[model samples]
Target: MATRTQILIPIGIAAIIIGAAGLISIPKDAKLEQTKFPMGIVKIDGVTLQVQIADTRPLQTRGLMFQEKMPYDQGMLFVFDGEAIRSMWMLNMQFALDVIWFDANGNVVYIQKDAQPCKSAIETATCTFTNGNNAKYVLEVTSGFVDMYDITENSKLEIISI
Candidate 1:
């Protein structure tokens, strides 16, 4: 007969495997909260953008992926629980876009202009992943979004989340 430890070890392993699978399995069309956070909008020369806060790990990991298109005045605001370096890839993105990284204080830490969509498994200038390891928030928008609105480093992002 198998020892008690041996039997329990297999059960424990199975439990961990199941939990891991659940954590990694986020639906492509997961319907997260659609409510908008109440905060001052940042207008780059009066071009307004509606930002939706993604303050959870599941939401952050899904960062604009599998979206067919983004509305002209709409964008996603990825919020982290704490300050940590983060990076973004253009994998599964269907359109050319831009990513603006922000710090915990909502200051623009970095920006990648016109990030091209990845059409294949290979990385290219337009399709490659950009690292914003110093960023806390990653804002995804259409190509030429920043220049079109004249947004720059000094721009501030208002956060109304506690």
Candidate 2:
């Protein structure tokens, strides 16, 4: 029979090995900086939202993809050079969203609520696209946000910062 000391020694070594393996298996992106994107504050009616600014093409292209979920008070804002027709897709998204399009003067041009994610390859290939006309900015938030906040086409966006 193994002595208690010998048994405990092996068990502790095994535990350490398992812990190291688990840490190693964690994705590198999991440790990415929380402040990777520039932050801004926006308001609709009287409600406020803290948003990640996606002003660059690369940032806009990667908007909200691969993320697990967004906080209720947080969103992503896409900024464009000028007001025009804008389009968005939901490929590789992990959750549904509510998208709002705002024109240059902060007027809500259009709204797309509860846009579903496309997780699989087939879904990605056939993903639905949401578009709005004369939109200079696009804001994406968690699903049901429009109804919760009573956001409408007439709602105006107060861009506190960008």
Candidate 3:
């Protein structure tokens, strides 16, 4: 009886391992719609920018975390549900980026260019821009995107998220 029990235990363990392996085979399709949001086109200094609006918690928390690259003329617009002292950081960013803050009037209130990605020994807050006040939206783009597009203070940022 003891010998039979030992053999059964090994077989059970093998079966469990096989079951776990099957469980791990779940398909992983890239959730492209996860990044797509109600967006609009806005021209800054005659350059058009395609943007995705983010106005919810999930949208705000996942702000461009896994994106491999953003086009020079494209960006992600983070729309806050309410007015606040908005700030941004580059935690999982693979490349440098620029953050532009907009006030309630849809005007560019602050622009932080060439934002450095987070490093083990480096702090991003040191390089962050805190010039925005009661901002309602934040825009993220590639490094030097603002300068390349000539986006500056008083630049109009149209939103179709409403």
Candidate 4:
């Protein structure tokens, strides 16, 4: 029989390896939720939300695709270089969301609410949704946000950042 010291040593090493591997598979939602990103306060109608900025290309591409849950009071804001028709797709998203577009002055230009997750039927080419409107910014919040908060095309936004 192997000595107790030999068995215990192997068990501890195995645990360490397993823990490291588990970190690699941690869901993006959990990691991103904990990350420190530039945050801004957004108000539409009487509702308010704190949002993360996705101004970089990599972050814009990620765009809440892998996240499973977004807090009601928190969201992600996408900033573009100019006002143009920008389309969006629900490729790897795992939860429903509401996408609201804004003009340069932060006025609501268009809205897409309750956009379903396409991770299950991800191979289908029908997952894209767009209003084909010109917008300089996009805000993605939890599902039902538009209806729940009564955010309409004429609603205004007051974004303040520190």
Give the winner by TM-score: 2
Which of the numbered candidates is closest to the native, going by highest lDDT? 2
* Candidate 2 lDDT for residue 99: 93
Q: For each predicted model, how many residue pairs clash, with residues at least 3 apart or on different chains?
A: 0, 0, 0, 0
Q: So what's the TM-score on candidate 1?
A: 0.64
Tens digits of per-residue lDDT for model 4, 1-162 = 999999999877775565455445444543463444567787777677888887766566567766778888889888889998877667567888899989889898889888876643323245567777789888889998888788899998777762
All candidates: TM-score:
0.64, 0.75, 0.68, 0.72
Q: Which residue ranges in model 3 land beyond 4 Å of their true spot?
A: 1-39, 121-129, 160-162
**Which candidate, 3 or 4, has the higher TM-score?**
4
Q: Please report the TM-score between candidate 2 and the true structure.
A: 0.75
RMSD of 1: 10.1
Q: Please state the error at residue 19 of candidate 1 in Å.
A: 23
Model 2 ranges with Cα > 4 A deviation: 1-35
* Weakest lDDT window of 10 consecutive positions for candidate 1: 31-40
Which of the predicted structures, 2 or 4, would earn the higher lDDT when compared with the native? 2
Task: Tell me the whole-model lDDT of each prediction, alpha carbons only.
Answer: 0.66, 0.81, 0.69, 0.75
